[model samples]
Target: MIWSSASAGPTNTLLPAGGCTLLPRATMYAPRMLAAVAQESQQRCRFCTRARAPRSQSAGWREVRRSISSNASPAWHHTRSISTSHLPRAPLAPAEIAPSKRVIFSGIQPTGVPQLGNYLGALQNWVKLQDSQRAQDEMYLSIVGLHALTVPQKAAQLRQEKWDMLAAILAIGIHPDKTVVFFQEDMPQHLELAWILACCTSMGKLNRMTTWKGKLAALQSASESGEATITSSEASSLNLGLFSYPVLQAADILLYKATHVPVGEDQVQHLELARDLAETFNRHHATGQRYFAPPAHLITPTKRVLSLRDATQKMSKSSTDINSRILLTDEPEAIRKKLKGAVTDSERRISFDPEARRGVSNLLRICAALDESRDAHGWAELVNERGGGSGMLKSVTGDVVLAKLEGVQKEIKRIKGDKAYLEKVARDGAARARERAERTMREVREMVGF
Candidate 1:
């Protein structure tokens, strides 16, 4: 029998014998070659008869003896020529193989203009991920307009916000070529896959989720405070899209077969839901074949920017007061005015205490974000040594914030003015995203018996 040796594993060794060679591997098929030889060989002369024919029996006998010494098994021992073509080729060792490409997908809503919190917490890190990723890996940053539609929006203003957000993303140095920056509503596959995932999702799990509850609670608070007209009983008026958007978020991650999803602490639960849905689909449809990759969360470093007005709460777009949050596109005058009016404790000392002195702590945190070299505690110490009160604290914070946002504002203005460039970026990003999504969908359809 012909023995193909390339299929041997690294741990496998060749066993040398008087008349044959044996390969030892994890799962060796076809019993020991010697055993096969003893069972198949009718007589000792058979080995001699299969040897290369010589002019005389004396020369032929010598050839058989040489063949046996060299451990060359004859191909016609059982009246059939053994072909090595059927042997399975072994794959390369792990160290010799190329590393698999990592697919990263993350998105943000264009609910309103992105603020300082959005930049430091999410957008800035996105550019870092894109710049540091290897060529084989892909990073996607989407403008999720669909998610924004969970609530009401004016058509003209929504369109403007989408373009404005895109310009802001570009201004922050996220390369369009390296990172896919598309509008989520532009891709129909996202919704298509969302419906499929929703079918597999459990109602109990959805009920257990707290995001919807938190949103309603915020709405109720707004109503009580006269910031909104909706009453507590009007919670039922909330749209189905708002309640079930988590499933769509899952679809977004799975559609691109993303391996990593960068999210904040608040969004970790949503990423977990995405992971569960992906695993559920794979279990039901793909079985042993994992067509969907359960994505992992690349949680952003915790950097919570509190409201300028009330440091107890986070900076949010829903806040009716524009000064509560600093917008990325805010002019120097506006930034100076907002920071000047920011609340601080009555204490003469500059200190960082979230529980006791929230407003002061918020300013310190903002300063820390703008200047990474100094943390909040370090800044607090520096301000204390300088004998600065709230005025000194506000001045220092405003100067740092303005210095950092100046280039960003200029870049955003330049990018927003280029309408054709913005359109091209959106179109190109959508095409690339669609290409990746279609590939995953095709495999999913086949596995689901579509």
Candidate 2:
């Protein structure tokens, strides 16, 4: 959760990350605490207004306690009495809507620096969609800090990572005005709504999920490979946070009532689970109306980006080897260095057969993704016709990749330097995101009897 500078006690004083202070006991909230602090905080500091904006609501402890006891609790309890007429009409089913009318929501975890796979696979597509979408199409870009907590992290590093992720997003051309880009931690509604959906979800469905199983397998493989020091017993002790992360993921989408989610092939299962939960929720609480849209997948063409070091696996930040993935922040020289060392087969001719030649195909895909004019197949054919082998392909790929990312890298540096601008973007984006989320949540409270 995003921290606040206004500390109630020594225990409450959270370390700063990005520009904001992390709140104390931020992740843990009993119903009483939810009613007391979260509600009060949102109401008081609703927006990070411009320099000329009026005074914000007081964050004083007594004020919060008094407000909770008087207004917040009663208001919450009053949801039971909310008339059906007070609620807005639910939109048409997924099949009935056009792309323009749909709300698109997607997120990336702020766990670490995003790599080349992250840029090409997800972030780049996000910007393209935003720019091309109809004015009616609403989009949200989330720096999902909560999801990062599923794995362990140092608080200081996580905070810094959170800011760094946002900067990368902005640098890559995600405008706050065109899209809502915010920290997932800022909104308590995500967790609150997750609990409600969790009740409707089955443990069996969660068990069948491939994501947790994949994590387990990866950890087991790491243990065997000596890449990570995790033991079998340690793997067995995987926390509930990691296990039930899909529920939180579901909440991230459903909270925004997102109609479309742009995802890679690996994430298709999670998206499907989101649809199931929405259907189940509608059946139980929606009362013949589907309150949450069953989010459809807006699968991109170049979805699966493999690791530079290991073409067999998707590129990842978890790998101990830095060369496994090309980070968005890498300098041009670093990019050249990594690409020069990228693994490829001995076959002199660069071909696009992924099954027989994954490394060459991966490089071809990277070049293809960077240059929108040519598809992967077309690029592969061109490279083969040019009589250039893997060496030539790697050199060309490096140049094209470096050229594409030049502006983004520069912008990232600038954004990092301007701490105030970073804070403003986060604050403003959080304000806008919370506004939309609260609307959905109010209906949720009414339907679920609070």
Please report the candidate that would top TM-score against the real structure.
1
Give the per-residue lDDT digits (tens) of candidate 2, residues 1-450.
110000011111121222222222211111123323343233322222222111143232221222434443332211111122223322222232243476788888885557888887778878888898787878888888888777678999999988998898889999999999999999999999999989988898888888778777878798789877986556655889877888888899889978777766666677767767876777678753446656666645555678889999888888888888899888888888898888897777667888988888899888888887887788777777778687788888887898898898899999899999999999999999999999999999999997
The lDDT for every candidate, in the order shown, is 0.72, 0.71
Q: Write the per-residue lDDT of candidate 1 for residues 320-376, one digit (tens) a residue.
A: 999998999888899989998898977878888878888999999889988988999
The C-alpha stretches of model 2 lying farther than 4 A from their native spots are: 1-100, 215-233, 377-387
Off by over 4 Å in 1: 1-99, 215-237
Pairs that collide in candidate 1 are none
Could you tell me every candidate's TM-score relative to the true structure?
A: 0.75, 0.74
